[model samples]
Target: MNSKEFLNELKKYSNDLLVSMSFDQIFKEELLKLYPRKIINCHAGKLPFYRDRNILNWALINNEKEFGISVHFIDKGINTGDIILQKTYEIKDSDDYTTLLNLCHKECASLLYESLILFLEDNVKAYKQKRKKKGGGNI
Candidate 1:
């Protein structure tokens, strides 16, 4: 079924929360209108910094000493929503893409579980990302 149709069916249920993981499609505005801040997602990146796709590859290419998993509210922008929880894992010298990805998979699962528990208990808070100033370098 299409997203709209799926959402239409979803509205029949009484649940007030939606959790998304690794969903490639964007939620339609109509769905967002109905759900608003009720939709949440877990990302394998730190967010805002690694907002778009291929985050793990980029982190490895950038030689980052650490990588992060983030759970946040789903907003219009890609991974620009308020952060609910984040945890970082150190990048060991012997780690490859596969190993790092496996680590992230585990951490992401744990973070998602904890975040959901906190959210259900009303102990979680969303923090908006602080905007950074654009560079003024001349073209």
Candidate 2:
């Protein structure tokens, strides 16, 4: 849980690194000397909206019609990253929080895997998602 252990473990992964710190708590001193590269995060909500936690819950509560996943570049602002790729799915009225979340999680994992493959192949830059611009998702 501490910084030293966290950084050490992160260094073990190839092409993947983990930093155990709140976005606000991560300081430049901890990473300034390290390699400067694009850092991306997959989010459950669409960008410029639904920017915080419990995305699926929010979608269900708001009665959205569709929900999707977004892979984007991390920026100083939350959920404001430049989108790389997005995949969406229809939300059924019978879908609850758990169902919606499970679906979104599956899509997120797939997107990340596909994006990594694309990056390795030098075939793409990033993905951008476009959500349904209508009513909220099913409750």
Candidate 3:
């Protein structure tokens, strides 16, 4: 089903939180309004930097020394949400695209677990991204 239809169905359920991992479709403003800070997303790249698709490829292409996994509250803009947790992995000389991708997936899983714990405990203090700055250090 389409995103709108899916959302309409979702509204039938009573959920306190929404977790999205590698979900391709963008949540519309109406959905965001309905959910507010209830939605969270796990991304394979640092926010306000590698915002969208193929982040692993982009990091490799850019010759980055490290890459990160971020969990944040979902907002309207692409990955422009308040960050909840972030973790970085070093890029080794021997690492190829596949290797790096694998690493990202592994680290992402761990980060997600940790972020969820923090959220459940109400220990997570999310920070807003500075739109003026394009990039920053790894977490």
Candidate 4:
């Protein structure tokens, strides 16, 4: 369904919170307006880094020794919202596509749960992700 129709259907629900898990497509502005920054999303890759699609494959292709999972608020720009939680993991020589995928699956579930709890308790201290600068250490 289109965003408007989907939103109309969502209005039938009683909950006030919205969380998007593995939602590959970006939401239309109509749906985004419904929750503003309150809509949270769970992304498998580190923000401002392994964003977009095929992130896992990219990581493997790059022979990355570390990976991450990020849970953040969804904004107009995909994977560019303030981060709620970001956890990194080490990749070993034995780790392959399936292994990495499974690790992310596990971490994403637990971390998303933790992030929501922190939000509910009003204890979350979200920070904007800084992209890597020409000579900067942060990204």
Candidate 5:
């Protein structure tokens, strides 16, 4: 019913790390405080850029030539967490939302895996995400 109660329940589980991709829900202060940098997320879109959902379509509708993926520490803000890794994939004229989404599926998995390794090894170096620029993600 509260932070302490929730934490006690969590302690019953042996999960040492929390990383997400399909989890679009926002984590408030209490949960965030539990993990700090240990709470990570592989965002489907570029942080502070194409936030929320429908990112692939946003990129396509905006006539973007590239699609981006970011793995970051999940902060209280909406996808405004510190970035662990960010990489973009080219979007050719023939590509559509479905294609971009598929690309993100692969890229997100790869990036998340790489990030987790770095985290477990204590080799991670996170950087604050900059403010949002124009739509369609910053290049």
Candidate 6:
């Protein structure tokens, strides 16, 4: 389903969950204020340095040493959120875009599933992020 369809369905269940539907930046700011818990998002690539699109393409082009997925809180800027979890897989020198993408997709799926499990069991605190830091560091 498209974003509009998905959002419409989400709105139908608003009573069971918080719902805010607006493209305006102020709406997002308002959400940040009203929501008590963290706001999460799944980034397709390792964040900070790899902030642009088509990360798989970029990773292959640049011949990266590693690639990964990150689950992070959504802040004001792009991919600047506090990282809740990250999982990386080494990039083989001979690896191409397709292979690297498969690895990234696998990690993303695992992390997403794990995050949902934690949310349901109320053990999300197990992966609580450390203090937010600037850009990419050792990981």
Better model by lDDT: candidate 3 vs candidate 5: 3
TM-score of candidate 4 against the unseen true structure: 0.89
lDDT of 2 by residue, 6-54 (tens): 6567567664422221143432334422423346677787665676777
CA shift at 25, candidate 1, in angstroms? 0.8
lDDT of each: 0.81, 0.63, 0.83, 0.81, 0.81, 0.60
Candidate with the larger TM-score of 3 and 6? 3
Which of the predicted structures, 2 or 4, would earn the higher lDDT when compared with the native?
Answer: 4
Q: Tens digit of lDDT per residue, candidate 6, span 1-139?
A: 2245654574565331232211233225545544434556667677665755677777777778887678766665666666666777788888988887767667776886777676667766534344436654323
Candidate ranking (TM-score, best to worst)? 1, 4, 3, 5, 2, 6
Best by lDDT: 3
Locate the minimum summed-lDDT window of 10 residues in model 3: 130-139
Candidate 1 stretches with Cα past 4 Å from truth are 133-139
TM-score of 3: 0.87
lDDT of 4 by residue, 1-139 (tens): 2366788998788655688887768877887777777788888787768777767777888888887889998888878899999988888999988998998888989998998899789888889988755643122
**True-structure RMSD, every candidate:** 3.4, 5.4, 3.0, 2.7, 2.9, 5.8
Worst 10 residues of 5 by lDDT: 130-139
Question: How high a TM-score does candidate 1 get?
Answer: 0.90
lDDT of 5: 0.81
User: What would the TM-score be for candidate 6 when compared with the true structure?
Assistant: 0.65
Clashes of each: 0, 12, 0, 0, 0, 0
Question: lDDT, candidate 2, residue 135?
Answer: 51
**Per-residue alpha-carbon lDDT of candidate 1 for residues 30-131, written as tens digits (9 for 90 to 100):** 877788888889988876577777778878788889888899998877777899998888888899899988887888889889988987899878899766
Predicted structure 2: lDDT = 0.63
Q: Which residue pairs show backbone clashes in model 3?
A: none
Span of ten consecutive residues with least summed lDDT in model 2: 17-26
